[model samples]
Target: MSFEASRDKFQAYLTKQGLRVTNQRLAIFDAAFAQKEHFTAEQLLDKARAIDDSVSRATVYRTLPLMTESQILREVDIGSGEKFYLPASGTNSQVAQVVCVDCDKIFEISAPFMEWYGSTVSLKLGLKPITQRLQVSAQCIAQRQTGLCPHRVAK
Candidate 1:
């Protein structure tokens, strides 16, 4: 989505929620949208702070939940046990990720069949499904052979 459209949608959501569209919130939103990959709240804070030093960690943390609730951001668990945020537009109705336990690399898979199955189940249960995520953990041979995974942080 264009920056202006995202900003307008967020502003409208904030107004509907009876919340003020503070500068800090806008900064956080812009920073998040600028990131092309999934990011943790701390990563978002760093990016936001880089854009505007006035942006605080507290503000970013506070705004993240609001953004998720507003459907502007979606929280993802890539098997790291840490909450990662991604643009909701990037992750539509359903997503599936394979996490390499050794390398901590998350590979997203195209699963239209999964979406269809989920929708069918939701319909059978008489419920509406907003979103669904499936995570599978496995080991990658390359990581085991090299003993180094670029994405994995050394403990």
Candidate 2:
């Protein structure tokens, strides 16, 4: 969905939840949607503050769950202590995440077969599937061999 549509949805969700659509929240949303790469809460706070100096770390932390729960963002956990988030594509959820263990870089690849696998496995188990995720952790070959990550933008 377009950012405008998602913004409207987010406002509606906030109203439905009896929450006010505050400026800080909107700044956090803008910062999150502006990211082209996966980011952590701390990183989001910095970005939000850049847009609106009044944006607080606490607000960023609180707003993140709202965005994810509303399906405007996708949460990624790579067995690392910090959680990463990226804007939801709003097209397909059947994507696989490949994380570079050396650099903590994340790459998303479309996995159309996941839909079939989810249905097949759920049918055999007599259960309905709601969602599915496949995450692969890999070491950067370049980093391993040359001691440098070619796509290492992660901290």
Candidate 3:
């Protein structure tokens, strides 16, 4: 959807949630939707400032946590006091991700991976699983023997 459409929709959503639609929130949503992949608050502030050139770092920092709490944005905690934010699209309550430890590259994986994994372990122990949050990280060294990733190849 277009940025304006998304902004209007999200504004309505926020209103339904009894949240005020501040100018900073709208700017943040625009920046978040326009940006691809995960971004830190500093990165978001840079983009927000590029658009308005008057947006503040403190606004971005304060607003991000509100978005996370409202479920409009998702935060990936890297466990180093660094949290990356992204628009809540593919992410749900059952989302799973594979993050690179060295470079902090996150690849969103199939959510069913969590359920399948939980089922395997629960069946082994003869127990029923209630909820699951399984995240795994791997560092795959690229080799010349294999072909390039389709997403990486130039058009």
lDDT of 3: 0.72
TM-score of 2: 0.97
Q: Pick the candidate with the highest lDDT.
A: 2
Which of 2 and 3 is ahead in lDDT? 2
Backbone clash numbers for all candidates listed: 0, 0, 0
For candidate 2, the clash count comes to 0
Question: How well is each residue in 26-115 modelled by candidate 1, as lDDT tens digits?
Answer: 889989999876778998998898888899888888899898987788787775678888777744455677878876666667777887
Instruction: Give per-residue CA lDDT, model 2, range 18-83, as digits (tens).
Output: 999999999999999999999999999999999999998888888999999988999999999999
* Model 1 root-mean-square deviation: 2.5
Model 1 TM-score on a 0 to 1 scale: 0.84
| Candidate 2 wrongly placed segments (more than 4 Å) | none
Please identify model 1 stretches exceeding 4 Å from their true place: 90-92, 122-130, 153-155
- lDDT assessment of candidate 1: 0.81
List where candidate 3 sits over 4 angstroms from the true fold: 1-9, 13-20, 90-93, 113-132, 143-155
Candidate 3, position 81, lDDT: 82
TM-score of each: 0.84, 0.97, 0.70
Over the stretch 107-144, how does candidate 3's per-residue lDDT look in tens digits?
Answer: 77668667778889999999989867655775545423
